[model samples]
Target: MQLSCPLPKFDFDVITLGHGSGGLLTHRLLQKGVFDILGNEFLGQQHDGASFHMDGKLAFSTDSFVVHPIFFPGGSIGDLAINGTVNDLAMCGAQPQYLSLSFILEEGLKTDEFSQILADIKTAADKAGVKIVTGDTKVVEKGKGDKLFINTSGIGTVHPGAAIHHQHIRPGDRVIISGNIATHGMAIMSVREGLEFETSIISDTVALNHTVYTLVNRFGKGIKFLRDPTRGGVASVLNEVAELTELGVDLVQSRVPVEEQVEAACEMLGLDPLYVANEGIFLAIVSEDIAAPFLQALKEDELGVNAAEIGVVSVNHPRKVIMESRIGGSRVVSYLTGEQLPRIC
Candidate 1:
C-alpha cells in the first residue's frame, strides 16, 4: 500500500545539528513530522521507551541497515529496515507485532528525502502488520555518516507449534528455499556498478512473517529449522547448519531457484550466486514426509511462489554441503571466507 498521508510543512528544508540537539528543533521535528506521521497508541505516549505486554513464548531481534544508495529498485532503506527485523523474527517462528525504529541522519540530509523514507517505513510496517511503537533520532555531521542509517528492534510472539532447532533436523530431512537467491544483492550491485539488464532486477525485500506463521501452525514439528539468508546467503546458512548438526547437505544445482537475469549478472560480475545476499527468501529444513506438502503449501503463498526443495540432509559427507551439478559433477560448498558484499542488508 502506498503512503496516503501527505508530507507536513517543515520550518527547515534540510536537517541540521539543531534538529538532533534534543531541544526546540527536535521537538518540532518530532511533533510536527515523525510523531505526526507515525503516531499510534503506544508511540503517542512519547516515552523514552515503550512498554507492552506479550504472553507465552517471545522472540526479539535487532538489526541495522546501511545499504548504499538508500533508495534502490523495488524498495528503499526505510522498508528494508522494517522488513529485515520482521523477517529475522519470522525465521525464529514468531509473529512479529511491534518494532522500535531509530534513525541516524546526516546533517545535510534533505528534509523531503527524509519525509519520503518515513512514509516508506510506515507503509512497510502496515503491510507487515507491525507497529512502530517508539524510537530515537540522531544526526551526525555530513561526510561523517552515510545519507541515512536505520536501526530496528522487533518483538514477536513465538508460534506455539514451533519446535525449530538443529536437533529436530535429521539425515533424511529436505532443504527448502522460499524463493530465488541473489536477487537483492544483484539489485544493489547493478545500481552501484552502473550495470544494466534487459529487465530491471528489483530487490526482493519483503516480510515473511505471515507465510512462516501459516507453515509453522500447519506442519508443527514437521518444520525442523528456519533461517533467512541475509548477509551470507544460502551457502553460509546451509554450511552453518551442517557444522551444528554434523549432517551432510546434498544440493542439486538445477533445483535451486535463480532468476535468469540475476544469474547472468552474477556471472558477468565474477560473483558466486551461492554467496550473494537475499533479502526476501528463507531456508527451511523439513522432515522427509512433510517436505512435499510443505513445498506445495509454500508455493500457494504469494511470497513463496518459487519455493523449491533445493537440497537434503544426509550422512554421506557429514558436516559438508555438496552441490551436484546439472552435468552430474559435485563440489563441496563451504562457509563464505570474507565479505562478498559490504553494507548490504
Candidate 2:
C-alpha cells in the first residue's frame, strides 16, 4: 500500500549542491521533504544519531543500494534498500524493529522522484515492521553519482531459540529454498534490455522477516543455517556453505523451482537460473527430521508459497556442490566466477 503521508510543499524542483550544504536548503529539504514523509517519534527527536533501548541478543546489519536506473518491475531502489537490510537481519533469526536510512543524491535528481522514493521507503518499513529512526542526506554533482543511492542499517532482537550457524550443518540436513529463484535478476535485466516476453517477469523484492521469524520460532535449532542468495545467486551461496563446513551439497536439477516465464527469459538471455540473483527468497539448511515440516510451514506463509527442498548436505564430495540432472547425470555447481549481473541488489 502507498504511504498515507504525502510530500510537503517545496520550493525546489531539483536537487542542487546547495541542498547538501547543511544550510537553509538542507534544512528545508529535511524539514519538508523527509521529515514530513517518514517522521516518527524516534525520528522526530532530530538528533545527529538515533538512540533506542532493546533487551537480549541483538543483530545489526548495514547494506548500500546502488541499483542502476533505481526503478524496476515490481519495486524501486527505495523499497529494495529497506528490504535488503531487513532480510539481512531476518536471516540471522531476528525480529527487525528499527532502521537508519541514508541517501546520496545527484544534483539533477527531481524532487518528485525523491519524494516518491521516500514514500516507498516508508511503505516498505511499515510492511517489515521497522521504523526509520535516523538518516542523513547528501547531494553530489550530476556526473559524480547515480540518480540516487541508499544505505540502510538495521537492528533487531534475536530469537531466544535461534541457533543459526554453519557449524551446526550436518550430512543429513536438507537444503530448502523459500521460493522461486531468478525472478529479481531477470526483472532488472528485462528493463535494461527492453525485452518483452509473453508474460512480465516482476521482481520478488518483498520482505521475509515475518515468514523467517515463524520458521525460527517453530524449528529453533533445527534450522542450522540460513542465507539469502543475492549477488551471486544460489550456486555461490551453496558453494560458500560447502567450503565453510567442508561438506557437500547435492542438488537435484529437476526439483529446483523456477517460473516458466523466468526460465524462458533465462534461456533467451543465455543465463543460468541458478546463477541469477533473488531478493525475496532464502536458502535454509535444516535437520532432516524437520525438513518436511519446514517446507510445509514455508509454503503456508505468504512469502514462501513456492518453497522447495532443492538439495541436501552430504559427505561425498567435500567442499563441492553437485547438481544431479533429471537424466541421472551429475555436475559440479561451482562458485560464481565472474559478475553475472552487476548492481543487482
Candidate 3:
C-alpha cells in the first residue's frame, strides 16, 4: 500500500496544518518567516525561555490574548500576549524580567500557524528584554475553542525611586498619551472582513516597559498614574482612573491623536475611536511642572513620537469623563454599555 502523493506547490500565503508538526517545516517557517522579521539578541539564543537579571523590588502581572483572527496587520496574538503582560508590569513602573506562557489550541488547528505564533511570542519577549521562563499547552475539541488562545504571565522588578498609582493622581495633573489611539482595533477590523482603504493601518501592539522605565528613571514620583488602555480603550481607562481617584477627567478633542485611516474606518462603521483597543500606547499622569520634560523624553522614543498632553485631572464632576468637542461643545464620554466589537483583545 505504498501509494505516493505529490506535495503541492506552496503558492498560498495563508497558514497550513503541517507548519506546527515540530519538524522541518516548523523549523523553516521560524527561520525564514517569523524570526527573520523580529530577530533580536534575546531571541537569537533560541532557548525555551529567555533569562535575564534584575535589580529592585519585584512586580508581577499576567494577561491573555484571544483576539479573533490571531494574525493582524502589524502584529499577532503571540506578541500581543507577551507585550500585554509586560505592559501591565510597566504600568506599575517595573522592569519586566520573566514570563509564563500557556496555549490552548483547538483540534484540527494548523501546526504552521501555531508555530508562527510561538515564534512571535519569543521574538516579542526578546525585544522587551524579558524571558519566557515557563509555559503550558492544551488541546480542545474543534468548535469548542477558537483556533488558538494564549495566556502570558510576567514578573519584573520596580525601580527604587519609582512610585505610581491611581491614588497619586490629583486635580491639575496633566494627562499625556504615549501615541495615537485606535490603530490596533481598526487594523483588526480592516483585516477581519478584508476592508480596503486608501491608506494602510497597522496594529500598535508593543512592549512599553522600556519607555516607562525611561520615564520613571527621570521623572520618579512626579509620574502619578500609568495605564495601558486595552479592552475598553482610552475612555474606559480614564473612567476607571476617575472612579479610583474620585476625580474628573477633561480631554480636548483636538489634542487626542487619531490616524486618518482609523478615523475614516470608525466613521464608516459608526464606531467611536475612544472605545477601541490599543496595544503600543499608554496614558501617563504627571505634575504640570514636569510635563514638558516628560513629553520631551517620551518623544525621543519611537513609540512616543506622537505623545501629546490630551487632557487634565479636574476636581469637578468626580468620576466622570467630559470631552470638549472639536466644535467647542462639551459632551460626556460614558463607559461602553455593550460590547461594540468582541474578541478585540
Structural similarity to truth (TM-score) of each candidate: 0.97, 0.97, 0.85
TM value for model 2:
0.97
**Per-residue lDDT of candidate 1, residues 1-345 (tens digit):** 245766655667999988899999999999888877788998888899889888999999999999987888878899899999999999999999999999999999998888888988988899999999999999999999988999999999999999999898899999999999999999988777555455589999999999999999999989999999988889999999999999999999999999999999999888989999999999999999999999999999999999999999999999999999989999999998988788877
Sorted on lDDT, best first, the list reads 2, 1, 3
RMSD of each: 1.5, 1.5, 6.7
Report the Cα lDDT for candidate 1: 0.91
Off by more than 4 A, model 1: 1-5, 193-199
Q: Which stretches of candidate 3 lie over 4 Å from their true place?
A: 1-56, 194-199
User: In model 1, how large is the Cα lDDT of residue 176?
Assistant: 98
* Total clashing pairs for each candidate: 0, 0, 4
Better of 2 and 3 by TM-score: 2
Could you give candidate 3's per-residue lDDT for residues 1-345 as a string of tens digits? 011222222323544444556676556645665455444565567677776776658898878789987987888888789999999999989998878777777767665566567667766777899866655556667787888888988888898888798878889999999999999999888877555454488899999999899899999999998989988999999999888999999999999999988999999989999999999999999999999999999999998999999999999999999999999999999897799778888
Error of 2 at 268 (Å): 0.6
lDDT tens string, model 2, 1-345? 244657555668999999999898998898887888888898888899888889999999999999866888888899899999999999999999989999999999998888888888988999999999999999999999989999999999999999999999999899999999999999888877555455588899989999999999999999999989998999999999999999999999999999999999999988999999999999999999999999999999988899999999999999999999989999999988888788888
lDDT of each: 0.91, 0.92, 0.83
